[model samples]
Each structure stands twice: as C-alpha cells, then as structure tokens.
Target: RSAGVSKAHDPRHAAKMFKSAQEDKTGRWLAIHFTSHDNPHISRDALEELIQDMSKQSYRQEILAEDDEIQLSWLVYRAFNERTNKIDDFEIPKNWLVYVGHDFGGANPAALFVAQDPATGNFYEFKEYLPGAGHSTAQHVDMFKELTTGYSVIWRSGGSHQEGEIRQGYSSHGWPIVEPKINSVKAQVDKVVGTMELNKVFIFKSLHNRLTEVMNCLWAPDAEGIPTDKIKDEEKYHLSACARYLYCNFTPDTVVHNKSRTSHSMSM
Candidate 1:
C-alpha cells in the first residue's frame, strides 16, 4: 500500500491511514508526502522561476508541503539577510541621503525610512510605520515629523488614489514631497528582483512590520495555475508599495549627492 498527501487531501487523515498501515506488518507499505521542492526532476533554473512566480501559500502548500493560511508566499524573503542586510539599529551617517516612502491609504497608511550609503550606493530601510484605520492625515504627518526630526527627508508618495490629499497634508506641515511618475507594476517588481539579486537592498533587524510585508507579498494566480503580475493580499502590501516606490524611483545618482547633500528626482 502506498499513500500520498497533497493540499487537495487532508493531511491529518493521511497521517492516520499511514499509521494504521504501518501497524499491519503483514504487507509492504510506503507513504510519501511531497511538494514541488521535493521533486528531484526539477531543474535549478526552473525551480527558481517557479519560486519567483508562485504565491506564498501556493509555494508552502505545493512546494514545501506546509499549510499556511496566507495562500501567497513572499517574494523577497529568499534574498533578505538578517545578518548582513538586516542589521542592528545605528545612527545614520550625516552624509547619507535620507528619504521617506509613503503608501497613502487612509485605513492603513504605510511609511518607510530609507537611507543610502554614499560610498557603496546600497540602500537600507531602517524604520517602518503602519498606522491602521481612523488616523487623520495630520496625525500621520505628526508621527512622521517626530521620527524624522533632524534629517533632511525627501518624501516619495505611492498610489495616485489619494495622492493630492496626502501631498497637501505633508506640504501643509512643511514636509518636502514629490510624486515620481508611476511605472508599470511589472517594471517595479523587476527592479526589486534585480536589486536583491545584486545584494543592494538591506533592512534594519528591528523593522519587523516591513519584514513581514516582504515575506508575505505574493503574486496572484490565474485559473490555469499561472502566476500573474497582479499582487494578492492588498492589505498586507502597504509597506511593500512604499519599498517599491523608493526602489523604482530613487537611485544613487538621483538621490545621493557626492558631499553637498543635493537632491534630484527620477522615475523608473
């Protein structure tokens, strides 16, 4: 007898059946539980593509054989490092350019504090804030002001849904702001992939909220089980949107000045 367990079947029931079969030692019995990651026939390139395209839940259940409530898998965890990238909190160098990326949704407004290393051109996301629901724009601005008191911050806004209102709110409080022309979603995602591949992005170890978003954001799947460019789990992607805006819009030449701290804007 042989048994296999998949997302289509109950793992608990499969375990019970396998245990019962094991007790009946009169006949040869084999039980196998496997996911896509378990298959020896898959090529390395194919596996990487599959992982890049699959949703988190799909990857966990179909590739790792683990049942995760979130159907989509994260797109970034494979590249992020807690030791090298995710470092301990430290004072950002005075010469480093600092910027804030904002995803402006009234229900769950998200912001990320990013700093660029002048010498290496690498970017570090050091802090994140997600104030959920019922918070006014003034309140959000106040919070940001408190966090970025001394730094000269160049604010980048994502999503045109409430762009005008958000800009006004920040501008009223004397926050310097700009809206970079939005690129195609695929282009933004590709930029992130390229940065990660080159090991140019980093995060502070204490920014758990942003890390969680990075680990949970997933691509939506079509009826034929193909991953689409559309992202699933909108509620969990606020911080990701902020990161994408900064990644797609801000570059070393554009945002970082040699020593004068001059600011420039460019669109990806």
Candidate 2:
C-alpha cells in the first residue's frame, strides 16, 4: 500500500479519491485495475473526471489501458482445473448455472453459458461456446458432455430438429436437457427482461461472443427503439431465445400451471 492510499469503499468515495490524487503534483501516474463491474454506459466525461482527479490528487503513474481478456475454454479450464474459489463455486446457494445455445449448422454454433446466484440474486457468468467446435456429432457430444456435466442448461432453437439431434446424441449420456420453450419476439424480449428483474442475469465473463450476439440481436432499426421482429443476427436471436426459455421454465410464475386437477373425492 502506498502512502496516502486509503481504500475508497463506495463508488462515490472512490471517485472523490481519484480527484484528490490528481490534485497532488507529486502524483505522476495512475494505475488502476478494476475488479468491480464495468458498465459501457458510464459517460466519457465521468470516466475522464475520475482519471483526472486521481492524477491531480496523488503521485500519478502511467495510465495504462490494459484489460485481462479470458475466453470460455480458458475459463472452463480454470474453473475445473482447480477447486473453485468460494466466489466462483457453482454450488454456492445463490448460484445457478445453465447453457443457452444456437446452431447455425456447418457454421460455428453460438452459445451462452449462464450462471446466476439465486441467494445473492447476482449472475455469476454468461459465456459463449462453439457447438460445432468438435466437428462430428461425436465431437459435439463431447463438447456438450463437458459443457453440461454439472449445471442446469437452457437450450434455444429456431426449430425442433436440433433439439432432436441433441436428445439422441447427448441425452443418453445423461446430459440434462430442458425442452426449449419457443416464444415470439415480444414474448422472448419480455421473458428476458422479466428474468433480469427477478434475478440477476449475468453473462459469463468469458463468453464475449455470446454476450455480443445477444446485445446485437437487440439492436434492430424498427419499432422505434422497441425490439422488432427482424432478427438481424440469427445467432443472437437464438441464444437470447435460450435465455428466455430458461427464465420461462424456472421462474415460479412462468412455470406452466399443472392443469390436472387433483380432487380429494371420496368414491362411494
């Protein structure tokens, strides 16, 4: 710990400290590693202000623009390679893990590996994977086997054929397959939104491709900013659809009501 370095506990406090540091002529550099969440929404001015404040208050160091980018394969390797930390443990009370995927057929199939902690109501991670990575059905089977060894998975499809393929290929291997609950565009969007409200839906840190696909899917130029029918990115629509399916299946209210009425009728 450097001198005059006190931990700023809150975001506002951290921002104030940055300002304090920038004012210090002795500060020549500012090296910051953000372990906290980064939102793309923060304004440039706000970011600049924080940076400038830190530089001015403390002995500013070089402002380095470096980000640690981890991939899904790497994350999986890491997660399974060693005992997961309490922070990353999939078994944590608040945590729920699932996979949402789409197939482009012959092209790299897209997927989002999602995990949410119901206890904390925070998303652990939503990541993307290539279903076609292994080449043959055996390869896909292996990938699916590895991908879904221990978590609940939600799969989304444009149709049922792929589901059949998955069932035949992987279900026998004991890969848990939840039926893909198909929904229209508005319904799908609503499902995603509703899930987010009910529980924290965090995209896995490693799955940038899947995250990007879902975000892109939401960006169509119709319905005046409302998400429209035209799914510009088929991959995105498919993955997001999977996400909606997960929400629809698990959330209590969304779960289909058991219509078979049970009567405690005493037969005469």
lDDT of 1 by residue, 1-268 (tens): 5477354222234445655676766777765667776688988788898888776646766678654332323343345554477677788876676778878776888888988776766777888998789987677778988887777665455665447766777778766456645556666666566666667788887888777666656676676455567777655678888877667664433433243432335531
C-alpha lDDT values of all predictions: 0.66, 0.43
Which residues of candidate 1, in runs, are more than 4 Å off?
Answer: 1-83, 251-268
How do the residues 187-213 of candidate 2 rate in per-residue lDDT, one tens digit apiece? Answer: 555555554544335444355444444
Error of 1 at 139 (Å): 2.2
TM-score of each: 0.66, 0.46
TM-score of 2: 0.46
lDDT of 2 at 263: 16
